[model samples]
Target chain A: MGGLAVIEVVALDGDDTLWHSEQMFVDTQARFRDLLAPHVDLDHAALDARLLEVERRNLSTLGYGVKAFTLSLIETAIEVTEGRVLGRDVQAIVDLGKALLDHPVQLLDGVPEAVDALTGRYRVMIITKGDLLHQESKVARSGLAEDLWAVEIVSEKDAPTYERVLRRHRIDPASFVMVGNSVRSDVLPVLALGGRAVHVPYHVTWELEQPDHDPADGDFPVLAGLTHLPACLEAMGAEAA
Target chain B: MGGLAVIEVVALDGDDTLWHSEQMFVDTQARFRDLLAPHVDLDHAALDARLLEVERRNLSTLGYGVKAFTLSLIETAIEVTEGRVLGRDVQAIVDLGKALLDHPVQLLDGVPEAVDALTGRYRVMIITKGDLLHQESKVARSGLAEDLWAVEIVSEKDAPTYERVLRRHRIDPASFVMVGNSVRSDVLPVLALGGRAVHVPYHVTWELEQPDHDPADGDFPVLAGLTHLPACLEAMGAEAA
Candidate 1:
């Protein structure tokens, strides 16, 4: 709310905030419903319930992924139908699940341009969570790779990691601005560690990124999205000047 | 694949892997299209493109969340209508957006059960990311709070934080097992810190949670979900004994 300082560093969160990662699963789930609609008289709710049960039972055995979900859908159909599910129905579900895995990753709106704007002024870094190979592949394919100063695909965004990152970048926490959708991960830790943080709410957030602790104070500011970030930084830069 | 040890701890990630957090946006967009279909000839793709453009422009300005996304949807609708949008249409969209904020938080199947099972044998912790208030509320409402020994709703989940959590809990890293859907957050860091990790994949993961780094040989074990976690611990317990 006060006069801004030109942000020297801008760190962003990936996932629902930056791109269309989670929606793909929803679309695929819908596709799964459509695939099995003819063979079973189940509504989306019923189908979903059955699939969820199977998924629950197999969570540790199958883990998470489109393939597992799809396979579970097939298994659920067979179970709900008492093993009378048509072969075509089973096969269709499997094929659709495979198709989901192969679907191209789609970036959310404004991401590229916002990255461009921020990169022009601030050292941009991606502080995200996930598998090592998977997150990196997304960054490389996201079309914003060249614009970033560094991409820290981390396991978590806690204080220690943020400190390590700051030490690695040799940037003062005061000059750095953490920007992302998850307030718990991207903003809170940065602010807690004496870094400036700007929260850009994403369209979707994974449940894990949900915060578990109360904020100490008004250390972090929440914004509408990335569009207003550059202007904020410019204003901050002006104030600093 | 090595013989399991007595499981002393379990950790989890929040986000698409857990529940219906991300789909709300997609559903809202779909609802928006349905609302505007009668007045305008705009299809889902056209409307999505416009909204995407607005979102891109507002990323830095607005940040992320249903509030900004809903506003963007309304703005896009108005743009498509050339500023002649009806009052009812505007109110409907606004209501739809507001409705999303009130949507009940839903947990993925097997989560509570998995937590319950693990709780009987091991100390459970939830090391998720998000706004403190929001995430804590979810934990309180999840019905699994009673099962956990501690919850580290962190802004980040990296090696140092993991070490800190272990120290705080007074548990040996070698005796603990981090179970989560994210490879980056739940598995890799714990394993990197010389702790055992079990990966349970979620249906969808935030882009940040995708693994970008290569595993350093036998860094962790991947499981289907928490259902098998008890057995893993039992095997480990036997081996230790």
Candidate 2:
């Protein structure tokens, strides 16, 4: 907080941080787990692991997004059902994916206000990693478009990607602050690059996005929600006083 | 040619224009066709039709790039063979995809030089549409990275996408020229946006990328190869003079 005087750029992550994302994936997966349970003799944990295995295996080819997730679900279904997955179940997964895509943009509490508050004072932008069209559409639907300076829909949220974003924008890493939900992605990457990051925990985090280390043990600032952001920044700003 | 003075940005398409892209896809599909041939009574044309059908059907959800193409191939194999596709054949498709991913970058003749010729005079960029990581990796591997201003790996190439790119880069469409292989993607979009486009036709075009209208019959400049680009530009420059 004491080093806050140097901060100039505020980059926000989409998905869970700004809106409800992983919950849709989680809910659908839960239903999928139950739907496929009768056909396969596995319990919930094992079933989850099976789907995760497919997702991890297909990550290189499929990448991340609802389409990839849907494909992975179908593959998982086929694998568990021994290639006997019902046509109806595959249709259900497809429908689930469609619904997720069609899901209305429900911005998290205090997001619009938080972004508005952070806009004029800082170089505000949204740097999210997902399917370009999907992410772009979500941003369009979120109604936060006019408030921010830029929307960077990237492929990943690794340290190098964050560094590249900084480099692209001609922003010094020391003066950038990244805010997001994922410790592995939004928090650690920017932190590693000597950029500041504030973690705002989402209730449902994707398994792959969970950090290896205990997130609580990390030195980066963690806040309960975005509504606390203005106060948090103010406290840091006061430190400069 | 008369509009040469208006040109300020030369945005090149990556895949087929700068390097050999669809050739790899064509080759893999050929191998896949052979692998699936004995299992079905369909001829090569029929097989190609089946694969094309599946690819068209999945284009929306699977999106574009080698990953989607590979998934489409697998799904086609499953559908055509009525779920009788052998495990070895499936492995072959996976290996085919991996091989495509690992394929060496082959720059087209005189591309670097053509881009180099235009670099200093214009705001050069490479704007390609595909899976984000895949296209980004292609640009990195293409060795033309340093020769351009920026590499935009977009979800789609349409008038709106081009408009967005121009807006992002602060480029004027009237002063922009897009060069690429596909008429559907590279040429028409920019042309529709009042930007010029040069068609450098690749021998093998994706079926989906074939413009509905004949490009040869259109008003935009069409060149045989990348080597001819500089002269074509010079002719336009002469018109302006």
Candidate 3:
């Protein structure tokens, strides 16, 4: 095909790409801080740092998802309170995690249209990293499952993961385009594999998911929002074709 | 191929089939029952029944895995104790879940050799369900990653799920053979997909995974253990060939 049609497959990230998720996490963290307020003297900043530390330590063992986040929250609560944290408070934290898991999946404006537009000319898939059931439920609830060709719920979104997905789907890197919110996850990895990526910034980015290196340094387009994705991909396809 | 060489692919269940998992869960449940003993008047049977009830209710929402199991444990504790459970006990439950997540994956007797033998002739994959990260970690630690063709970690094991996996991997159901411990999750689903299955009983089966109908009524073999898998598969292959 000579990579003539440089975008035969369009893979988008699930959370914060097609729908809102990190904001829910941010709100939950705020509530988590409040839940520990009366028990511990730590300010919100210190509490967040300590929680992040615990999350980092547990990341290797627990991986990521609501469950891991909840576990880290409980551990942080116990440690911050020196085991004096109240049972009711613990229950509150558990309730918060459950609520977050039960949070309704709200699609970002224009996500459905953009995905549908891209699906007309390209194979579309959701490449998300989180708990399998949780991600699957969100995708099913998002009203986009039927629009996409496949939904990949992975544990991590690194270069190897992107490579595996592409290889399994039998897509050439030169003809694959990934669109997502996280540069660290959706952009750099796909770019590393000689594929193209588009960065659409989400309002809330998880601290751990923040890109260490500036995304501007990468050779990819940063659209104003997911709404601009269709036009952007169309222009790229025209230029390549 | 005329389905002449039946059983082109052999997929094995991870938990209980390849490694000891349910016994660990059984041990954790005992500990959970003990932790709630002093806080409630319910006897062991009552507590067990209540916990199972909560698990069933949460199963649809939380799905399954150690995290779901742990969340159910904490919820059951709080409910049974009427919100009077101690923070220390909640922490204990979280710790139990973490330890289970960190549990060493002990392969069943003859698993490695059996998998190696199967891989020599047929394409082999680990088709298991649960937390994606947990299952991935167990497979990675089980020292079997280098042997198998792929590891499929699913959310639920049902007929449609089996159909999806087989269709995705381009494996014909007629040439696929599934071996696992649970008739409900492993055997029945594959059987419904027109694939052959072998039931290898684990010493301990989770209450939720128990088959309602007797497995004996199904047209599949129930082996004494995984150690006998090779011989059984060999006989079946010879019969088909």
Candidate 4:
């Protein structure tokens, strides 16, 4: 197969890759800061510090997800307030976290356009990692659901998990392309399996999505964002055929 | 590729596939019964009922492993004995459960020979799922580590996971074959991915390994045990090629 024929499937990553996720998290954190201000006299920085500390300590014990994050916030609020946090304040904080679940998923700039450009030309899939229910909820609410051929919400994006997705879809690794922000979860593993990947950096990345600095050999391309994705796909497609 | 030239990678599942894992568990349960007889004053049927209850209740919280099983035994003993269980007896029962981990792994009759016969001719991989530390430890201690091309100890062996393994090894799904005791975890997923699978029954299977039955499509063969694995691989190779 030559350049154009080499690539058939284009796997797009969700969360911070295609949407403004971390910014939403920041928004949520700000609300948390406001809710606890009266009781704690703490600023956003101090609240964020306490939340991070609680989150770090509870990682293994609580695992990951909004539920855990919300609980951490409540725990931090109670601690900072010296057990004097009001019930209404606590309820408001909890409601803000829950509200995130229903928030309109904002697609990153040019994402919908890029996805549209690749729609008929390539098989497009949403390959993301998060809590199943939460991730699925995001997909449904995103308004880009119809643009994807399939949506894969996995617990992790390791080599084994990526392989499973490809196999399930019956797409050959040589013919598939993974497009995401994270160097670690998105790019490296897909490249390791002889699959192609395009890195589209997000403004702010969650720590888990950071790429591995040291990687096995492969000329994986890095794009500025979704705006640059179509051209990369065109180049790979031409090279593959 | 032509019908006869299509390559296949036949993955042989260790543990319960070509061995007597469940029997060992049953034996351990019997020992537990014997140990708790004096203090519990429960009949064999009653003891079995209590053990099953403990297993069901702890499935999500504790997961599957020797440690969980041992803990269940201790908890059950305490529950049945109603605080009458002696310290010495408790210690002995715990020790009995702990011994299971260190017990010499005994592959079923004809397993090693079957693997040996196929090793030289096929891309055979050992794919089993469990706690990473415990599973790897068992594989290393089993003395079968030297005979295979690769060993995949996974948390789950769904179709996607198997596909990833093949991709990592640079093999085609059409050329891969999965042999194991599970229909849910092994057989079905491979078939879903356009790969072949062979089912080899084990006497006692962990509850998690039990798969619901579906009508066979002739994509893969189901066999009795490891005794038939060599012939199955040869037949699949000839058919694929």
Best of the candidates, TM-score: 3
Better of 1 and 2 by lDDT: 2
The CAPRI-style docking tier of model 2 reads acceptable
Q: Find the candidate with the highest DockQ and give its number.
A: 3
- Alpha-carbon lDDT of model 4: 0.72
Q: Give the better candidate number (2 or 4) by DockQ.
A: 2
Question: To one decimal place, how large is model 4's interface RMSD in Å?
Answer: 14.4
| DockQ head-to-head 3 vs 4, winner | 3
- Which digits, one per residue and each the tens of the lDDT, describe model 3 over residues B120-153? 9889999999889899999999999898988899
TM-score for candidate 3, residues paired by index: 0.94
On residues A1-241, what C-alpha lDDT tens digit does candidate 4 reach at each position?
Answer: 2232467789988878887777787888888887777667777777788888887875543444554465566667767876666545654655565566557788888888888998978888899864445666688777888978888766567898898788867888888889888888888888888788888877777654455577445678888889888888888777766
lDDT of 2 by residue, A1-241 (tens): 2243556888999999999999888888888987887788998899999989988987765678876677677777777887666545555666677677778989999888888888868878999987776888899899999888888988888888888888888888777888899988888878777777889999988888878866444477789999888777666556544
Ranked by TM-score from best down, the candidates are: 3, 2, 4, 1
Judge candidate 2 at residue B220 and give its lDDT.
77
lDDT of 4 at A158: 82
Relative to the true structure, how large is the alpha-carbon lDDT of every model?
0.66, 0.81, 0.88, 0.72
Which stretches of candidate 4 lie above 4 Å from their native place? A1-5, A41-43, A60-63, A215-219, A239-241, B1-241
Query: TM-score of predicted model 2?
Result: 0.86
Relative to the true structure, candidate 4 has a C-alpha RMSD (angstroms) of: 10.4
lDDT of each residue in A36-105, candidate 1, tens digit only:
6666788888887777777777543333344335546656766666655554455455456545544566
**Candidate 3: CAPRI quality band:** medium
**Separate DockQ for every predicted complex:** 0.02, 0.31, 0.63, 0.03
